[model samples]
Target: MKIAFPYMGTSHIAFKMLIRDLGHEPMVPPKLSKKTLTYGTQHSPEFACLPFKILLGSYLEAIEQGAELIITSGGSGPCRAGYYGVLHQKILQDLGYDTKIIVMESPYRNPFDFLGKIKSVISCSGVSWWTFIKVFYKAWEKLKLLDETEFLSHQIRPFECLRGETTKVFKECLNVIDESQTTEQIREARKLTQELLNNISQDHTRKVLKIGIIGEIYVVLEPFANHDLEVTLGEMGVLTHRSIYLSDWTRESTGYESKKNIIKAASPYINELFGGHGIYSVGHTVLYSQKGFDGVVQLAPFTCIPEIVAKTILAKVSNDFAIPVLTVFLDEQTGKAGLQTRLEAFVDLLGQKRAIQEGVVT
Candidate 1:
């Protein structure tokens, strides 16, 4: 099968390589464009959420490019993400597209469900189990490594004045991995990527007020969806940490069980505060506050239930910890200028609050 993966932040880079290793042709949609958003918004139900619309556009484009299968993540929880595959499948079918939609559901509660979904896809493509396992393992490792690189890159993006250097390093690392099949080669690429990241200088004296951004994966990771908010915040001398990195999600799945044991030891209330889709997000915010981050900024697409739930709980956490929290809800009609105005206001408020707390603006 000629598989296509939608462009959703750094994840796409790993997915593209995964498809190739699986002996399938991988097609990546063009970088997020105005046309993409426009078409998505026009075709999708008005309140479906921003990420879904953008992905719809990406799938349509990939189908046009001869992709017979479209692969995306699936979820099982209170989060609307659980239904994206079905929704998109219906939309595409309604539009007369014959592409098969492959959803790799997260193996959170039901390992059997995850296995079943993968088996369905592999059976459809007639891929052998041995080959599938081999490629899947390699693909998982690549994704883990890519997520690590992206997390480090985000840590530096706020401090770097130029974007090209970090992006260039990421691309180089991907190229190195794509060309290499051995574990030794993958380890070497990791080392080189780490060294490149450490070499990037940080602005320690700039007083970049730290903000925690939490939200749905797509809106938080995609620059186009958020209007380059991370870059914009960095330009305004504010350090921002987004909570939706691939590594975080990966850990949430694989290591969450053990990690929960540790965090629970520290504070049971912390675990209880975030009940569902945002359990990790709320936990991370408390962690960040303890680390002295100035504030928390939560961004979610309008009608995102999990994030909304997260926001409500975070409000209590923020108040209890005295950490200011700002929540921004986004939708198709959200304008760039409006977003900038809100961001500027948010920064100003955080700055003033910080100054008063530190006696810098008496």
Candidate 2:
């Protein structure tokens, strides 16, 4: 089958590899752009969050390009993300598209069912179960490497002496990673990726702002949806650490359940899972503040309930921890210029606060 999936940052690199290795063609949609957002917004419910609209737009385009099956992740929560598949299926049917959609839910919810689903998909390839296991392991390893490389880029981008050099090297490294097929190739790519990043000339004497990024996973990961907020922050001399990564989420959802500490950290504010990553966001914010980050930026869709909840609690977190927090809600209509202005002002605020604490200002 010709399978397709929506884009989320560099995740497509791994997903494409996984699908192709499974003996299916991966029909990735075009990169997200204004036109894509417009198509999604036109077909999507007006109140749907930006991710939903963007994904719908991607699906439409992929279907138009002859995608036979669409694969998407699903959730069970008060968050609207849980219902996106059903709603999307209905919408596509209404629009006269009969594409098959496979929604992968949390394996922890039903391990047997999850394995059964995986077996059915693997059966399509006529490949042995051991082969499927090896392929999936390789894909997962690649995802971890990709996430590590990206995290390193965020740390290095702010300190690079030559403007845009870090970005240029990062892109080249990603291409190297994408082409890596074997375990040894991936390890070599990792070494080269580290070497390339370490070679970027950096101003060690320059003081940089440390910022933690938290919020809805889609907006946090998808650069287009967030107006390239991570790269923009890096370019402005701010080092950013995102709270969530695809590999981490995948590991936890696949029954590892290693986030108890994060959940415990959120106890003082939001003890229970309020659907989505509300508790995790709060926990990560608290953790960032303790780590002495200068500020935190929370990105969310306009009507994202979990983020809204986190935003409200974050105000208290900011006051109690003496850390600055900025919440930016995104949508199809969000403009880059406005976001840029807000970020500049926020960074300035952090700088002034730091100077005051050091007695540089009275």
Candidate 3:
């Protein structure tokens, strides 16, 4: 059976690997684009979050490409992600698409339920337990490789002797990693990519502003959703760091405890998990402040409830910590030029503030 799933950053690199290895053809939706956004928004409820609408658009596109079974991640919380599978199925049916949707309970809610869902799905497709285990490990390894390459890219981007070279090499690495079909191929590609990234000359003497990004998972991880904000900042000579990542979330969702839980760290500031990334967004801001980051940028979709609440609490954190926090909203009509202008201004402000602290510009 052919399977399709919504694209969530580099997670798809590993996710697609899993499906293909299990002898199922994985039909990945096209990357998020203006056309995709338009298609999604046209058939979606006006009040839905950006990720939901994007998911719908992706499903529509994938179904058109011959995906018969849809596998979507589900959550259990005040966050609408929990209900996305049902809503998506209903919408597709209303549109006359007859594909079947399987809602895999998010691993964060009940690990057993998640495993059961996985077992059920694969069992129907006739995959053996040994095959499933091997495929799962291979997919996970891909995810770890992808995240490490990304982290390396972020670290080297700002200090590269040549602008855009780091990004160029990083893209090649991602493309190689995503296109690898065998575990051996993935390992070899990863090693080569690591060597390439390491060879990308960087100027250690150059000064660059360091900014932390903390926000909704989708917007933070998906470059397209966030207007390539991290890349934009890196090109402007600011080192950008994100607190939430796909690999860690993948581990947490799969029943393994994530190494870092900003939610726990943020309890002093926010006691309850308001669902979604709200808790982490608050915690990451405080963590960023503690790490001496010059500024923190929180990216959220318009009308996102959890982030809206986090935005409120973050204000207090900003004042208490004296760290500047910039919250940017993503939507179908977001313009890149305006985002660049605001980012430029924020970087300048951070630069001046850092200079003042160092008595360099005073």
By lDDT, the best candidate is 2
lDDT of each: 0.75, 0.91, 0.87
Which pairs of residues have clashing backbones in candidate 1?
Answer: none
After superposition, candidate 1 runs with Cα above 4 Å error? 123-128, 161-182, 201-203, 254-276
Count clashing pairs, candidate 2: 0
Predicted model with the maximum TM-score: 2
Rank the candidate models, highest lDDT first: 2, 3, 1
Model 3: lDDT to the true structure: 0.87
lDDT of 3 by residue, 108-150 (tens): 5677877887887688779999989888888888998999889
Q: In candidate 1, where is summed lDDT lowest over 10 consecutive residues? A: 268-277
Candidate 1 residue 27 Cα shift, in angstroms, is 1.5
Q: Specify the poorest-scoring 10-residue window by lDDT in model 2.
A: 113-122
On residues 1-362, what C-alpha lDDT tens digit does candidate 1 reach at each position?
78888776667767776677666788888777877887788779887888899999888877877889898877766666778899999999999998988787667677887788777767766788898888777767777787787667666766665645655665776676666565677778788888887787666556668887766677888878887777678667777787666656666675553456325432533444332346655776787788898888787888887777778778788888888888888877556888788888988988898999899998
TM-score of 2: 0.98
- TM-score quality measure for candidate 3: 0.95
RMSD of each: 3.3, 1.1, 1.6
- Residue-level lDDT of model 2, residues 1-362, one tens digit each, is 89999899899988889988988898989888887888899999988999999999999989989998899999887889999998999999999999977789987788787788777777987877898899899999999999999999999999999888988999998999999988899899999999999999999788899999999999999999999899999999999999999999999988665998888888888777888888888999889988989999999999999999999999998898998999999988756898999999999999999999889999
Give the winner by TM-score: 1 or 2: 2
